[model samples]
Target: MPSLRMFGRDWKVAVDDLAVYAGVAGLWHVVWVIVEIVFLARATAESDQPCIDSEIHLFTWYMSVDIVCFLLYALLLFYTLRGSILDVGARKPAIYILYGISAIYTFLLVINIAASVLKNQFVAPCQDAHRERLALAIFICHWIFWGVWALAALLAFDPFATTSVEQRYAARLWLLKCCSAGASEARPGAAEHIGEICDRAYSTQDEKMESSTPMSQIGALMTLVFTGVDMTTTDYATALILVRNAQRMDREDALAAGVGKPEVAPIPLDMLEDAAHYLPHALSIYGWASNVLNKQDIAAWGCGASCVAPCTGKDVHVGDNMLFSSKNMTIQGVKVMTKSNPETDLLYMSWDNEIQGLLPYYICIDRPRREVIISVRGSLSAADWMTDLLVLPVEVDANFLGCDPSSMVAPEDVKIETTASRRRLISAHKGMLGCAKTIAADLRRHKVLDAVLKSDQHAREALKHDIYKQDCSDHQLVVVGHSLGAGVAALLALHLRSVYPGTRCWAYAPPGGLMSPELSAAMRDYCTSVVCGRDLVPRLSLSNMEILARQMIECSARCKQPKVRVILHPGKKWKRDDLFKPEAEMSADARKTLEAYMRNSGSSHCAGGKVIEARDFLTPGKLLYYEANDSDIADALVFTPQFVDNKEFAKNGMLISTFAVDMHMPWMYQMAVDKALDDAHRGLPSTRVEVAKLEGTCYAPEAAAQTTQQAETDIEAAGGRPS
Candidate 1:
């Protein structure tokens, strides 16, 4: 509570302000009283007696006494309840006087208005016409004064004097506005915040300033009063505050008033822990993580804007720079610390791409937790996907898959490893960029796609060097990525596991065939994929081949009309072939078409990890979570094998929606991750979900052309010639 002593010097100022207010009101009322006295003397002289009557009793002697009585009562109440009125907790006597004045005067004003309009004279309308007019005017004016006094008295009453600054200022004005509102008001739970109101509303100047009244409250007050929301905004506001606060305090007086109730509910220990840990994490998702997607580095709430993604572009990406000293990056306002250190610095990793200039990804190391994170960005250009498209037929070379770096040797030529998963090609560009050699002039300058087909030791060595320099002394490395970046993260995480024992990766909305199930399962403990509810990207490489085939057929039809269509012939449905191994299921023509589609669209990739699916939001603004269990993602709730249920989902028009496709976007994936953290924090059960799993066998092509001749033509056509 704001104390008078806190503003010892300002007490005199407050007294002077109060005195000035009193002087003005007193002068106005005294002049009106003198007018009434002069009128009475005139009537007495005219009648030759000390008696006079008006058109109506209400506008005659009764109205004069009514005005005088309220003024006297107001003065008496101020003197008698001076300490109580200015103190907190509300004085019943002071409250009754104010409420009484407002009530009695309101009732009288209604009757007085009727009397004046009816022109009822003191004796009769004809007998005292002039006197009756003056009497009625005075009566109406007196009631108006009563109303004003009532309102002012209510706000200056006991309940407002001891509240916190916001509640104090809000006390008279809160009812006119809301919690998020300024002076023009808008809260459902306001009734409970009354006690808090009084302790804040320091009545004295020194206390008012010390109480730290927020500008929001001031705005709210101005909006209500100046905007004319109510004639007595302050009085109505104070009444609400006092009444609500009184209701809230009924708890303290419950038993004393013969009510069987306790003063407070006991705190739940588990809930306290949940609030302490989870609340910040949940809040931070919006406060820090979500802003990374906004174009600006800082929002109105003051969190750093790490997202530099151009709001208008398809390639927009957002990332944060945590190190305060980094140039051209959002400076960290608060020192992000590890458990072991009071102050800490962060690590940043950026690589240059031929198409997008320099793209920096975020890395945070929590030493006390022995964890490091590598966040990756998605493909942003035709050239970038071209890298993913120009797949090199190679397998996990056992010699290089594990630490034996000495045994690792760059491929003599981009060739198939007979023992490796050759039929399912890995993204040639991603593998090479990881090594930092895909930008070789041989490819861009000479227009030679073959030279860039292989990922050699340049990546391994650079990764090793980068890791050595970037290591924040944390042993556990966690990798996270979305869309095209998901495949890269999986590959990087599994590969690094050869050296870093605790490497784990999370891929969000990954396509199919990014990594083999054998590899995914091998790194099962180290990899997890999160697929959002029906996010078509993860399912696209599986069953959406049907959609691709249909689209192609449609495009073929459109060719006659000279309209463009993004049509690619559907390849063999991999999930169908994987399950049934039916030669009839995939005709030679279909096989060829599918291969062409995968080569061009680069859709046949899977996140090599556990896939968890999250529905964007079940209830607006409330996050939901799901658990994943599958070789391919399976929503435990809505999932059905694509081969078994794809036709039905398609028939029902529920197969693919824009929302589902958008779920593949980075922001949606981030929500899934953030929500998971929130659920885990509050100890809520994760929403169990899965999409139909993709499981089957496929005919292994014996070293399908090392590099399709068409791959070179496609890359060349898309502006990827040698620089």
Candidate 2:
């Protein structure tokens, strides 16, 4: 109850203060509002006096509304604060100001009310001089207090002071523009940031050495007024120091004006060695790993004209001396480190920073007619296994007919003894350059009949046919391969073209076959190659195959009709052997033809005329290898076997060779239509009444004999020893 009484007393005091504040503020505002409102309303009336009358009434009504609003506002404040006595710290200052204004206005209102009453009373009495004088004094004090309160409110929301130096400068510029035109034409609140606007303008002028302008003078004056206050603030002080330092630097440059032309040095090959000094960081290892094909020592790997050009000449295949400098040398940015078991020493290469998942790493650069030879005869570490059991091939029965099928399978426990071996035989052994030798030999031995016979045998056959038909007058040849395949293909194309100048192979994805860049370059124009993306299996050299190939095609003198493309086949479907499937089963007639073809082909699998691998498609006694090409044109040939079911197998493991055998049902049915088509196309012309005329056709043996005889004759004509 005592607490209630104390609250009640405070409430009364607040009420008294609010009443006084309202009365003083309302006095002039009421009159002003009434006059304005009366004039505005009366402007539409019949008489001109209505304007004056309307203005006066409107002023009175507006001021009275304000007084009522204030009284209500005071009550609202009391309600808002009653729940929290000491927690309104942020609101306390505003509350106090409001209380003071309210109290003064309420007092003025009381006096005004008293004057009305006294005026009515004293007018009749005419002798109340003391009361009349006291009324005048109260009126004068009311206006004075009103003026002071207005000024205080303006100060509380001081618009000149921005919280930070950056903002202050921004605001100051905004103000200066408004002040220049006296603010009537200025935007709203433009006057608020006058100080900020002036500061920026002056600062800008100072930066440009136009500090002597009139605007700068005004800016200096404004700064003087606010300097002391802002200097005390840490942020503004730091900003000022920074600006001053910038000014000093600008001045120092002005003092040392030198002869004007910018300096640049002449670049030559000699400077390349200086650039290579810092090759350690740029390369995967310390010493330069020369590309065996080209014999050029690449300073670094990957592209970046800016990073590499300073030390090494802009060309990627430069001497390591140029890349050794710290300026140009950098790690090959192309390498992507995969997040795997860190304890393990395996890092997979990705096109970018990280390999996506469990996909195999395959790097392919497709180029033709020019070559990028890498010589990675550096410190290569050899990794060997503990036992041969892990490395040996495992065999399982083709059929599940064994009595104890699981027991028949051998466990991986058998071991073979082996010794570690290393030999540095690279000094004289021809590397990928041997590929050229192989190609040359093949060309020398191959006849036109052989070319036609072997042509279009596989996808590579299609590529060879295209090469033969190509307009090689401008650009002769391109050789392409992936992994070790690329190296062989490149070498073959280059060597073949070097002697004959009639072939090209667009080689891609080459292994680092043992050949120097110089040797490869010497013979590569006859064959070009490209490497599309990063495949670390082929050691990354300073000069990338793709880039070098492209450069040669674009810039080299002897590289005729250059056609090298470094293409990235991310998920290309390479195998296309599903050519034998069809809608209906193999008919009785078609099955017979297929059987004959499989049994009588009798082609050797290698250069030595040895039997083909058991698992080769043509071989009958083994499972399908189901792998891509692995040998030369004839050697790498694939012949599909006749499909048969388990029941068709005889006790001796040979197929029964009967159409009605249940084991032959699936294949017979699956390939019926294709087999029929094959028969129709392959049928003998003598058997047909009318047929397409075949040209340049002959038996393999007859053609080989003719080719051998012709070659001997050519040798004899040239006065060489004939076989």
Q: Which candidate is the best by TM-score?
A: 1
Q: Write candidate 1's Cα lDDT for 1-723 as tens digits.
A: 012211111111111113234445556666666767655655655653222443333334544645655474555335332321112222224334434444656666666566556543344523356765666567667667767766765544543223332333344333433323233122322323322222232122344423332333243222211121111222232222332222223323443455321111112233223222222211121223333543335433221223221111122223433222232222221122112111122333343444212222344454544565555555654434433432221234543356442233334423453432222322222232332222222112221111111223353243332222333333566665555556555666666565556776666555443443334435544565545554654554322333333333222211211010101112112122121223343434334433443342312221110110000000100011132222222222221110111111222111222244555555554444445455545655443322221111110122112122322333333334322
**What overall lDDT goes with each candidate model?**
0.35, 0.27
What is the TM-score of candidate 1? Answer: 0.33
Q: Which ranges in model 2 have alpha carbons more than 4 Å from their true place?
A: 1-436, 449-477, 502-505, 523-527, 540-723
Candidate 1 regions exceeding 4 Å error are: 1-343, 355-359, 381-383, 395-400, 403-474, 540-547, 550-655, 674-723
User: How does candidate 2 fare on TM-score?
Assistant: 0.16
For model 2, residues 1-723, the per-residue Cα lDDT tens digits are 001112112111121122234344546455544544543343335234423343334234434544554554454344333311111232234454455445655655565555455444433333235433543443444455455665644433334322332233323433543323112111222233434433343232324323233323323332322321122122222222222223233333433443121111111222112112111111221122212122333444443433232112133443454444422222231121111111111111111111111111111111232211111111111100001001111121212111232332234422233322111111101222332343334334332212222332342243333222212234323333333334444444433443335554433323332233223333332332322111232322211222222222111111111011001121222221111112144333233323432232222111111011111101011110011111223222222211111111111111111111321221221232222223334541111111111110111222334434443443333334412
> For candidate 2, what is the lDDT?
0.27
- Local distance difference test, candidate 1: 0.35
- Please state the error at residue 554 of candidate 2 in Å: 42
TM-score of each: 0.33, 0.16
